[model samples]
Target: MLSALRKYLILPKLIRLSWSAPKNRTVAWDRYWAGIARTGARSDVLWDSGTDHELLAYRDVLRRHFDPSLPIVDVGCGHGAFSRALTAYSPRVLGVDVSPHAVARASGESAGVEGVSYLARDMTGPGAGAGLVGSTDANVFVRGVLHVLDAANQAALMENLRQLVGARGTVFLAETNFQGNPVEYVSHLGASLRSIPAPLELAIRKLPMPGHFGPEELARAMPKDRWTLVEDGAATIETNPLMDAAGNSRVPGYFAVLKAKDPDAGR
Candidate 1:
């Protein structure tokens, strides 16, 4: 009964948490890269729960849409394990993040790979990089990022990415799709976090739950020609690896593959 009550209390909080940025937490967006330099790109303490197949699927998409030789950007490229892993398939990969800490961590971790690099950029702001422009030259990966943003921010980010996609590139978006409990976890592949960038007040007024982008949410967010959703799948599990040792759970999330609506053109 107590557990059920706890869940019920957490539910409304999850809703606001899904859309608002953390207030007190101060992700340190400006100096986001500083810590990565100090720590030397480390594994995400929060996401120790990753898998081989998720990495493989990402690699396959890179191979499918863009050339291994061309440039690619991993937007919001957290610890960048995926970028490091991609080295097997591509010569050049770049990871972008808004947090200096995340960028530093990803860069430090991904640095050894010959063709991969890391940068820091606001998802809603300027020149993410060469790949941000799509110029028949690079592909952009916005994995596990956009869905966390509010609708307006998500739209802005996707539009910016669309510009980067140019005519012949691909954008792969893996999200915590909206099929799971906002208070518990996300879809088959991802879950919601009660702890977010936003703090208590923000939590009260805005964030109450974690989130997933609803179906058509992307389409509504982006222009028609700018993106084409190629394939989408969901993974649901009661438990799995994805949280900290002391506090993680196995929950499912959603994954999707998208290329420039015109595959031939992004090239």
Candidate 2:
């Protein structure tokens, strides 16, 4: 009875909190990243165990698919961690973010790194990158960014990315899917409720951000004719302790590889 109540009652409330979240996602994330920068903490620390593992997996995928000679763009590159990682494969890497503090920190921390640059710009805007649009082949990397935006902004960003990449471009995306696993969902929900204070928890619900989405939700959000889902799968990055007893330990998330559908359609 208790389990059923929690699943049917508490779970629905938690899900509703995400659905009705605020819409100013970009600004909220900018402030959040700025705050993190001010605290002198590396942005990589914000990644959970599952995310870290997924990143490693993605790196392997990148090594296989990435053309070493072409330039790579790291969209929503928070602190240049992924950009620096990409440097190992491609000499030319550009990291861009909307947060000035994050850009400053990334630039300062990676000052000595060669062939890698950081910029503070909103990729969704018209005047995002000067002289960057047609300078390189479109092979963009986006991690934990899409879900932060509302539907309109997400669509706009996708359109912008498609434009930046031009024809025959590829987009590698890593995002959290709350509907991936039941055990993982319950575990995360319990942890969040415990870690956050009551008032702050309420505030989070009102924050202008799409907390997370399911795999289907994400798939539906993509422009069908503009983008083709080439590859996708669950992120078995970590084990769920709650499901250990059942010998099922995989946590929930997803990664996808999308290609421009028409290659020359947007151009």
Best prediction by TM-score? 2
lDDT (10s digit) by residue, model 2, range 1-267? 685445444445556665665356666556655555221221222332223444677776776666667777899887776777778777788888987877877787788899889888887776453356355665788876776666666776777777666554578887766653432354443423334333223434544433565466566667687778877877643332332333333445677877776654443
Q: If candidate 1 were superposed on the true structure by all CA atoms, what would the RMSD be?
A: 6.1
Q: Return the TM-score for each candidate structure.
A: 0.69, 0.73
Q: Lowest summed-lDDT stretch of 10 residues in model 1? A: 35-44
lDDT per prediction? Answer: 0.55, 0.62
What TM-score does candidate 2 reach?
A: 0.73
Give the per-residue lDDT of model 1 (tens digit) for 1-267.
785445455555555444444342225333323422222212223332345456664555557766555567778777776677666765667777777776666766655467777776776764343344345455676655666677877877776675566655567676656454544443222222344321122323432244566456777776677677777666432223433233434344556666555434423
| Top candidate (lDDT) | 2
Stretches of candidate 2 exceeding 4 Å from the true structure = 3-23, 37-45, 48-52, 127-130, 180-209, 236-251, 263-267
Measure candidate 2: CA RMSD.
Answer: 5.3
Residue 82: error of model 1 in Å?
Answer: 1.1
